[model samples]
Target: MNPLRLSPSRVNDYLNCPQLYKYRAIDLLPEEISLDAERGTLVHTILERLFDAPAPTRTPELAFALLPTSWEEQLIARPGLREKVQNDKEWIDRVRALLTTYFTLESPATFEPTEREVHVEVNLTESIYLHGYIDRLDIAPSGEVRIVDYKTGKSPKPGWEEKALFQLWIYAFIYWRTMGVLPKLLQLIYLGNGELLRNAPTEADLLRTEKKLISIAEEIVYSIENVSWRPRPSRLCDWCSFKNICPAFAK
Candidate 1:
């Protein structure tokens, strides 16, 4: 059996539709470029760049100034976006709205992050590796650690938050496994509406998350050995690039 590399996003993809997972993680099928994806990347890039300035110099004006260059840098990396968005000015303006909303949530000038875009990986088992990139990491003088993630989309409503929490749980598990200390806070900052969801994870919660990952890894390994990846059709199918090629969508 080949070693399985499972990230939070890939785990979500597999749960959403195993066939989609096979197309992506296994076969490496190409996906149609999405404007929303490009815009999200642009916004995230600008936010990350905002921290590159001196802590005192991190301002909304500076974040806005970083946009054009960030967009240009993104364009160079993903030139396909140039043909996707009809009006670059309008697109940039939309991204500006998100950046403006971000300032309303937290003053970036106030907090000095210990790390940005931090990549982490941990071995779940001999055959499984859990890996992900954290948006920002903050450490207090008191030895408390915080994991911060930025989302360009709207915050999840009541019962739907579990889905959003899943990624943070995985991050918490990784941090605990690697550092031997659970994070004091797990945060998700939604730029769409200036909403911040923060959770102080307990030892019990991390243990539960570890149990969940072990179960997920077992399921993935079984699926791999059996070569059974079924499709799950839902609203998400509407936006899936492979819908035309998927059996669930076939006549």
Candidate 2:
């Protein structure tokens, strides 16, 4: 059998609902792309491009200027995406607001990212391989590493912060396993509400994350072999594109 490749988002899909995973990963169904998600992609592209300029020139105005070109690049990559949006002007305005919020949180001119959209992959076993893209990776002067991810959505409610950090932990795990160094910090920058959520991960924390992933991978293999993709009903189901075909919700 081919190696089972898992990304953080794909792992989240299986954990959310195995049936949803089947539709996305196994069946390879196309999802209805949301305007909000597209806006987030545009903002991420602008931020990544912002660092290409000289550090002193990486200002909010420069970021704003890159918007048109960044958006044009997106349009070229995803043809017909513009027609899906109800109002292109209003949509661009919202994206601009997100970039504005990003500046208030962090001055791009202050620090240079060691890597942007860095892809890391590790083989856990002969058959299971884990992989993901780190939004930003910074190495401090003292050699401490920091992993930063951008979230275009609001910060999660107080009690749900750990769940929100799960994605970052996976990245930290991959970094640590591959680089042999634990990241000193894992940060989530929420542009929607201009909130910064940070976590200092310990070696033990990453170990637990690795174990959790292995367990999930094992369950995934069993589900595939047994042909038993079970639907997990939750409030998140409302936003799922495959709800109509899900056995748990079938009429």
The candidate scoring highest on TM-score is 1
Q: Weakest 10 consecutive residues, lDDT, candidate 1?
A: 79-88
Clashing pairs in 1: none
Q: On a 0 to 1 TM-score scale, where does candidate 2 land against the true structure?
A: 0.97
The count of residue-pair clashes in candidate 1 stands at 0
Task: Give the lDDT of residue 250 in candidate 1.
Answer: 89
lDDT of 1: 0.90
- The regions of model 2 sitting more than 4 angstroms off are none
TM-score for each predicted model, relative to the true structure: 0.97, 0.97
Supply the TM-score for candidate 1.
Answer: 0.97
**Per-residue lDDT for 92-185 in model 1, tens only?**
8899999999999999999889999999999988888999999999999999999999999899998888789889989989999999999999
Steric collisions counted per model: 0, 0
Instruction: State the lDDT of candidate 2 residue by residue for 172-215, as single tens digits.
Output: 99999989999999999999999999999999999999999989
